[model samples]
Target: MLSGSPTQGMFSNSRIGNSESPNSGASSSFTQPIIDMSENDETELLSITWNQDYHCFAAGTNHGFRIYNCKPCRETFRRDLKVGGFKIVEMLFHCNILALVGAVANSHYPPNKVLIWDDYQSRSICEFTFRSEVRGVKLRHDRIAVVLEHKIYVYSFTDLKLLHQIETLANPRGLCCLSHHSNTFVLVCPGLNKGQVRVEHFGLNVTKLISAHDSQIACFTLTLDGLLLATASITGTLIRIFNTMDGTQLQEVRRGADRAEINSIAFSPNVQWLAASSDKGTVHVFSLRVRVSGEDSLTQPNVAQGPALFHQNSSTSLDPLISTNTGANPNSTFSFMRDMGSWDGKSAHGSETFLLRLLPKYFSSEWSFAQFRLPQSTRLIVAFGSENDVIIVGMNGSFYRCSFDIVHGGDMMQKEYVRFIT
Candidate 1:
């Protein structure tokens, strides 16, 4: 996540002027310790994100969005006044148009509005008026999607322009996009009876509707490669993975009484693992397989009278759809591996619990989500945070940054870690 050494080691020798000028003073850079504001209530954070271009951290809170630049002692907090009568409730960003969905957090305000902001400038670039309060917001590629009431609206980036409008045919709750490669998307409407996810492609007429879970689809995530799709329910009980290509069911992953509701799901950059947030205030990380095996192949089940050598119970229980008989080429779909234990959700007291849990354990070298604590009792609604960059949302519309020490556990190491899922 976040990795930085003392600045003096990296930037000690520097000259400010031309070689001819012998009097040019030598310039030096020194690394300063990050100011830990958890000790003070004023610096308490609500939500934080990484501004990649700026190489610094930015956060959104009950007060306003604040930027934390690396420069020493410089002012970073900026109060947004352009979007009048709106206090930021959610901030979502993609490659373009840093979109912010805000309602009247202050009861004294009239009507609610969603503001689309430019990532770097901190200005309201586009505004959209909604009938009901916005429950969720997501931005992908050049399109911005929002959920209100039972409808999901997709719009062009900025200008608050409308693109395609779709009704969930049920209560629309959460929205997830398939990845940057395809314009396809899946919608989660928990209010509907059984957990159902609608897959729709933007341009051509191709849509797949299927029942995903026995209960509500609390959280879902698509691998960056767009190969695998994973979903978890509110019960924190069941998690399923699907193949993105043919809309086939892959694996059931896990099912049982888990202590938390699945709130957020994140895939490792390399697609080697997945991180999921639970309502019990913890995170779960699981290893992802790149290819299916002998019993997990899809060809055997559907073929007519292939060899009856393998028992039906072996391949059926893990994934009934995949077969080993037909000699069909194994599909590289991103689905869950049926048998695996969830990572432990234990927490350390006082200090940063996330820092400790996100590190590699003895048996499994991969990182996991561990429960971290806040100043007081706060019902964490949504966590758009990462190890180096995390923002936890509370029920009272309050938010705070949960900072953790960065450990070098992966290939891609960043100076500061702030993962934003839009």
Candidate 2:
């Protein structure tokens, strides 16, 4: 979900002094203000989203939007058109093309229209207008997804031809995620029923439905290859991972005992780790027991092949037995233990089932191995950076880069910090 504005008025011209924290390290402030404060213009941050590759992010503001590079933490450019503000600005990798939706504050670029902006041309080359406000827009090299309150529209990127329409449950948050892998195209969205997820595998022309949770889905995300999905429910205590192809539950990890409004969930590039952020203001990273299968495992399903079918094949599924064996190998177990830091190996489901057969399932739930605490007042989104590093972007205009110790999993070391907007 996108974060709401912290203040209503235009941005202040007065520079904010740097406040150093004992644990946050030395703050690296931007040399100049990213936004130009005109005497009459009013602006506030409406949204911030990282690009597909996590290299850069676009910040949507009431006045316009700005793009910033991720690693070095510097403003690359800004598009303060002044005509209206943008509620969402989605980038296609580092390309010049962007999918933009307008904020409610500006009628010039209303929320009902999606403007396909071309940075090279410095104008909207094409636009998609809808009956209702566009809640979100996602862009890929070959496709564009326009998310509405009750429906999602998929279009071909080449000609903007409508390809498919998916009916979903009330998706006020415009929850949608797409696979970035070139070999396959997978689109996941809310299903027709509550707590259900519809997975569209374009490569195989098949759709799989997974009942991810008993409660409504609060947040979810996919691995880069689109093979695995991580989902959190409105309860927000546990996050479940599923095999996108077969709708098999691979693993489950708990966020906490208390309920939280999960804001975002992210999978590491290698699919070995998963991270989640919520209203609790803490980012949790879990070492995954699931492994990415070979390319042959992603082959199209052969329904006529009987037991060999992808969906029916038990060997490929992460059944209880198979799931328990994950990371059980000597080398993998050692690595997993190292990554888990102080985590005892007792959390394994197989061990729990054997020793605590009469205990409640809650006692068997997997807890996060590492965590990074932030201000609880702000809603933040988390994503994996390089290796053990995690990148966080908050509604409070704060950006953080923290690294977890693979050998000690409690608190993450803050490597860098910056206030992108002030």
Candidate 3:
């Protein structure tokens, strides 16, 4: 029910900006109405994750998988169990059980399959089947990998059997696992322009094959001490940062001022902080350091500056507080240049900002609501839904939950709370 693109002008009700070029920094600003369903309900949703019990969070739609419960119900203001379903389209929870996958059978069936639900005991026990069409689904503890369509399988989450497959000759489209390394995993496929990343060591062999992004490689992350490795690329909006040992590339941050196509890359489980998402919905968070001088890289930690994904020439502009005219379009400004009079694109990009409100050209803060206009081209991913919440995911699967507080700390912050159509 998610994945979109029947065209029809890309299904719009109000993503407005029908091209509004004046610099496309787009900003008519308004958001915050459509919260939990309504305006005809349609619901297609698609991906959401966060359920090791932090109050609840699980979503994936096309016909199954829904569980929202973040405290709500002041006498029926809604959301008490409003959904909870679980039709299934990929899910994972381990130890307490809840592993799903079914959802990809249309022209009379046949599409890899694997469903194993049991959130406490809601049903479903097993199905497993694979030959194609799964595309990715991690999960670590008991270990599970599932990536069908050129193989990847793995599994063992306590008896779910099948332990090794990994065959990707090509086409994988993003898969992750390595918060601290259960065995090291990472795979990507910006539609397969071919941007290697192999790590595998389960039985020991392909112990690393990162050709690292020149193209493809759309999203990646791993710095819970698994030793840095942050990739991004759907062509460019730059975001390298490798060295997961030898893949070396360490340091590069460029953000959507022009070639925006970075959709997702996160890493803030305590490794400092580094969130990124773009396809114009923006969402940057930087603050990760380790650059000991000209050529140690993995930089971006002088602190105080916030937006501005690119543009810093004259020796990074003399750094008296970093700010070399982020204007000319670092996708519509916000690099915190020494406090340009209390810069506010809403905490930096919409928590609120209005100098007469005219901020388009790729402006960021719609806060949440990864996208509703189905039919592809939204991307926007973002992760970390538990320790302080982040989850955004939206190609068509729709998802939204934001909560950040940081405030001048190592990662610097302000999102505070953004329930954009949860």
Candidate 4:
């Protein structure tokens, strides 16, 4: 989700200072807009999300859960948790509906439970309790997907009635993503296999699993409409995209040749661009329309980034896994990846795609475009504030706004960033 406007507001008792300072190295074509609202404090942000309407963004802190209007950037509404910490939060697009879970069980809301909040009333309308701890939550218009360590429970958003239950491997983080498109309600998650990705078409009662990687599946994301799905492995060097409706391999890109931890994947609203951030302190952007021969977008064998920071170059193909050109393919997790030999295959249009080998921007020594580079730690959650701007929040309670301007083909592009929170 993106931040909508500058004058949008947030209301909190905490005194906030607002001023715009010019950023250095901004493109001459457009001035970089930077908003530094406040400095860092004792509060630790456990979770943050923006409503679909993009009117406000919510953050969970030791102080409590609070919402701030976008344009004005002041804390708006807040509900402090008496005992527990809110770890995962999902908001229905622009709706007053919110789904919340605690990182640790508290007397008010247990760890193994999910609380549904109606911000209009400033209280939890209802809650769903489970036997195991709830790892993640995603809300669509009419459905709610709750992730468990080893299973997933889909429920009717209206009544919270049991809809479907899916069993996965031991999923500790409870990762899952829902399509942002209004017409599509698709869900994707880690499958039973170590490197498999499962896609569920909620309206059609159908599911497809793709052999995404040979290593453990680290993270994956779905485009706003759910037509495209991107998956990365624990090795974190490569990323593959698959069609959600049919299990056909659409495209693949490399994040780096060597192993790095992938943090998140995002698609532009137009679906023309994809961006990924890893612990290597870099964010790689790729064009979906282009294909690379003998390489994925970020994968260039033995090649290092412009800054001389990255090392390693290995690529994989999407063969060996059955494709469903005519009908749904088999989704079996019985075969281990190592036993399946080489999955390397060439793309049909690999030779036609242009190459983009720009050095990645460093957030730290490994700078991520979305995170604050602190001396000790950096954890960033990225969201689009507009078509060309990215809003990032650090775990240490910092917010950053990055804006890009009119593109000059090739590597000539202007960009600027503002510190919204510290």
Alpha-carbon lDDT, every model: 0.43, 0.74, 0.45, 0.56
Regarding lDDT, does 3 or 4 come out ahead? 4
* Candidate 1, backbone clash total: 12
Worst 10 residues of 4 by lDDT: 19-28
Candidate 2 residue lDDT tens string, 1-422:
12222221211322322212111111123222223445456457899888887878899988888898889788888877545688999987877777888888767777987776666544444567777889889888788898999898887765555778889999998899998867668899999998999999987788999999998988889876677789999999999998787788878888899999999998887666789998998999987777654344345344223123223335543542133444432222223443444436344534433544666667666778789998545889888888799999988889999998765677899999999888
Roughly what TM-score does model 4 have, to 2 decimal places? 0.67
Write the number of the candidate with greater lDDT, choosing between 1 and 3.
Answer: 3
Displacement of residue 30 (Cα, Å) in model 4 is 51
**lDDT, candidate 4, 1-422, per-residue tens:** 22232212222212222111111010112111111223334556777776654446778765456666655456655555444556766766655667777666445555676776655534445566677788888877767788889888876654445667788978886878887555556789889998888898775667888888898888888765565688888898777777676677765666656788877777666554566766765555544531222112123332212111111232323322222221111111111222443336634332211212332322101111222232333655555556655555555555555544323212212233334334
Candidate 1 is scored at a TM of 0.54
Question: Whose TM-score is greatest here?
Answer: 2
Which sections of candidate 2 miss by over 4 Å?
1-42, 293-316, 319-351
Off by over 4 Å in 3: 1-63, 66-145, 148-228, 231-240, 243-246, 249-273, 276-422
Evaluate residue 174 in candidate 1 and report its C-alpha lDDT on the 0 to 100 scale: 43
What is the TM-score (0 to 1) of candidate 3?
Answer: 0.27
Residue 348 displacement in candidate 4 (angstroms): 18
